[model samples]
Target: MDLPRTFTIRESEHRIHNPFDERKLADLGAALHLKPGMRMLDLASGSGEMLCSWARDHRLTGTGVDVSTAFTAKARARAAELDVAEQVSFVHGDASGYVSSEPVDVAACIGATWIGGGVAGTIELLRRSLRPGGLMLIGEPFWRKTPPDRETVTACHMGSRDDLFALPGLVAHFGRIGYDQVEMVLADQDSWDRYAAAQWLNTRRWLDQNPEDELAAQMRAELTAAPLQHILYQREYLGWGVFVLMAR
Candidate 1:
């Protein structure tokens, strides 16, 4: 019903769960040109940031579903704080195989395609809830550059180079899957720093306060190594972006 404790604790203060900053999130929402009152269905919607913020800024109405109970609660509170509670709602449930009860203007699964196995399968799942000609949003990572070896790939947390495409290949992939890539917003190294580096502080603070906790050792080890690991592997080889698509 929730993310693993260590993960939740590590990202305890994250309002947006991915490697996207608030500015990028706003730009992505604006790029959609979503009309007022448009309905969106968001799967794996961590903390409902996209839904709630869009509800407030774009006058969007949406539902967000995620398996993380802690994040779901934060999402609800966020909706209320933004005065978008009536427009956006969040549900604490597994997003895998989820479909909206009604057709929506947008169907999204941001940074959590594993909910449906991968990009193609996740798209199929989202298609079930999208209105004809409606938009779909997928946030995913791509290869900035090919890794040098299996070790580098593993350092990037990917099983192999086949796990993702380079930027051009990723766009071509959408075409191959029968979708038109209408728009996209990419994340730079700065965004990656914000996303990954922020975890260190959170982990450090938690360790300082809960030194006796069982997970402290694990977090300490991770915090110790994650920064340089990210700089050496991910910052140079990995990239992320939110892509907008429509049925072709």
Candidate 2:
């Protein structure tokens, strides 16, 4: 099956789905100190950029699992584009409860923690695929500054202010899970804009091209409305980070 058409279309258009840029992701790869032939397991691996890039940069091997058929296809194409097809594989499947048949050096679930419900459960799921002393990478959101109202909180995808931890609280949550926070890279507002605003432009362009398509109308409506919603509610309140965790 495919992800919702909106998301599928976004992926196919090569829009950034997370608030991370190429430089930031490269910095994360450096922090990991990836070595040749290391194996990585990536859950909810959208477009498989992380795994595919890791394979190319570090000479590693890996498998990425995602539920989106469209994303999986794009991941395969990306692997080929990077000339790393032989080093990485993508599976179209649910990442929830997914465990590697063999332990991996790194297990990651970036920006898709729902695959394991939340940070704690996601870590446990990733740990099952990681060797002792191996690392887990979790990309999650936090409150940059406490939002002033329920509307702002909801736009940031939290039920209430308490639903989102501050950055320090997020680190402490990892500590409670028996993993030490080794390294982290955060997304600034610019990065967030790149991720969120780019999609609106893409959707707008698609609407122009496919005026008669059933989904085009919805996409056009979203394109018209999303920018205001994001700027008003999300840009100021939410923060995102990718943290590396190691068993303590």
Candidate 3:
């Protein structure tokens, strides 16, 4: 199983595949005070940046599972490039319902919580693979500002504003779910721009190379409209962050 070709095409260059930069990721690794030899399990682990980087820098070991064959290959290449191929590995498989064979020091479902249906279900999924006192990392979106109406919510690709909690509400949710939020690194508008805006360029470059490809027209339309849509809706109303949690 794999992600849609469109997704791979658009995010082909993204190491993290979410609205996060290297600095933010480094900040997260640092904040965790990761000691060498810790184990992590990252579900929906796009391109394996976090795992590979942490493996190299923190001397952590991890397995990353992803649904994208293309991204899985990239992740493996990244691990090799970082000289941490022995420490981290990527599996090309569905992350949904994936429980680790062994409990890990960290269990994560970053950005693609749909693997477990939603945030709460995803947390439950992650918990199954976490060792006692281990951390769970969730990367999710919250309402940066409550959308004024349905149109804005739709523009942000949300079914309804109710689908997302505000920042404070989301943190409160962790407590309600038997976890305490101990650390977080949030994405600002600039990171959103880096994530979404870069897709436009990737689409454009792809279109230039294969104007007659089956998906070219769709990509062209997206390239034309995505910038304005991102600026108008996503960059303003949606906030994203990776939160670190431990069971209470």
Regions of model 3 farther than 4 Å from truth: none
Candidate 1 residue pairs that clash: none
What TM-score fits each model? 0.98, 0.95, 0.98
Order the numbered candidates by TM-score, best leading: 3, 1, 2
Give the range where candidate 2 is weakest over 10 consecutive residues by summed lDDT. 8-17
lDDT scores in order: 0.93, 0.87, 0.93
Clash number for candidate 3: 0
Tell me how candidate 3 scores on lDDT: 0.93
Give a tens-digit lDDT track for model 1, residues 15-71.
Answer: 988999999999999999989989999999988888998998999898999999999
lDDT of 1: 0.93
Candidate 2, residues 48-72, lDDT tens digits: the string is 8889888999999999999998888
